[model samples]
Target: MSFFSEFREFAVKGNVVDLAVGVIIGGAFGKIVDSLVGDVIMPVIGKIVGGLDFSDYFIPLAGQTATTLAEAKKAGAVLAYGSFLSVLLNFIILAFVIFLMIKQINRLKRETPAPAPSAPPPTPEDVVLLREIRDALKR
Candidate 1:
């Protein structure tokens, strides 16, 4: 077969198509999770932690205008460990969501019906007839 035929076959497979769709959706889902982390959760956390903005928190290795952590990075200063903390929080949320998904999937798998037990083998017809004949002889 030609390369185009092989490509067509590859593209048409159900699993491959499903994977492509899943990747697209997963990218969108990642953005949503990022937004949730950045917008909703972070602000609440900042308030709880004494009005601290994570994105603004960074350490400047070298700079004059770096009056605070935020100013350093905004002024293009390097060595920002504080930003790492914000990313770490995002990772934690993502992990929790994945864990919950796996747990639900596992629960569904457990609830599905198992294979039925096999029936026992039947007794042979010849054995039954012989038993009846022996009983008649005795009678």
Candidate 2:
């Protein structure tokens, strides 16, 4: 087969298509989680912790006296631990959500009973005749 045909066959497979769709959905889901952590959760946490913005909490490594993380980076090197904390929180939330979803899916799967076993097919006529002949010869 030609290379294009082979490529087409591989790309059109069910698993490949499913993986592509999963990647697209995962990207969108990551964005939602990022927004939740950055905009909603982080702000609430900051408010609870004496109204300090977590994203601005950084250690200056190059003696730069910048106040915000963005400004610090522009001035010199800095360790942005607060940004890391937000990302870590995002990961935890995403993991928890996925765990819940998987748990629910597993529960649904368990609720569905398996199909009952089918009865065996009847013996063929030829086999039955052969058996009768063997029985007669033994008699």
Candidate 3:
């Protein structure tokens, strides 16, 4: 009825709560992925490609003769393609991991159908014969 109550109701809904939790976890996971790309994967890649840091790989757009990306940016506008590459790698890895998790979850959710109900067994031959004889006797 009141604004506060309405807001409270909306905020405490199951879907909203779940979404909030998901956002929090997603942010933390993003940090982890960023670290993985920046600290681990990028270093190895840079090493393989001749020991050049990807984050420092940028093109000077404003005619700055700076060596590092930080210096280039401090001097003038520069295209930071190296940082972009690292972030792109992070996104790819995160997407791949999420894809695998979703795939596994889907596989688990696919339930095998229960076997179809079978018909009851036929009556025994002796039972049928006995029933006929009893009916005849009664008549």
- Tens-place lDDT per residue, model 2, 7-79, is 9999999999999999999999999999999999999999999999999989999999988999999998999
What's the TM-score of every candidate structure?
Answer: 0.76, 0.83, 0.81
Candidate numbers sorted by TM-score from highest down: 2, 3, 1
In Å, residue 14's CA in model 1 sits off its true spot by 1.6
lDDT of each structure?
Answer: 0.83, 0.97, 0.95
Give the clash total for candidate 1: 0
For 1-139, candidate 3 gives per-residue lDDT tens digits of 9999999999999999999999999999999999999999999999999999999889999999999999999999999999999989999999999999999988887866678999999999999999999999999
Model 1 lDDT, full chain set? 0.83
lDDT of 3 at 55: 94
- CA shift of 19, model 2, Å: 0.7
Clashing pairs in 2: none
Q: Least accurate stretch of 10 residues (summed lDDT) in model 2? A: 113-122
**Number of colliding residue pairs in model 2:** 0
User: 1-139, model 1: which lDDT tens digit per residue?
Assistant: 9999999999999999999999999888888888998899889989999998877676566654665765676677567665687778888988999899999999999999998898978889999999999999999
Q: What is the lDDT of residue 31 in candidate 3?
A: 97
Off by over 4 Å in 2: 116-139
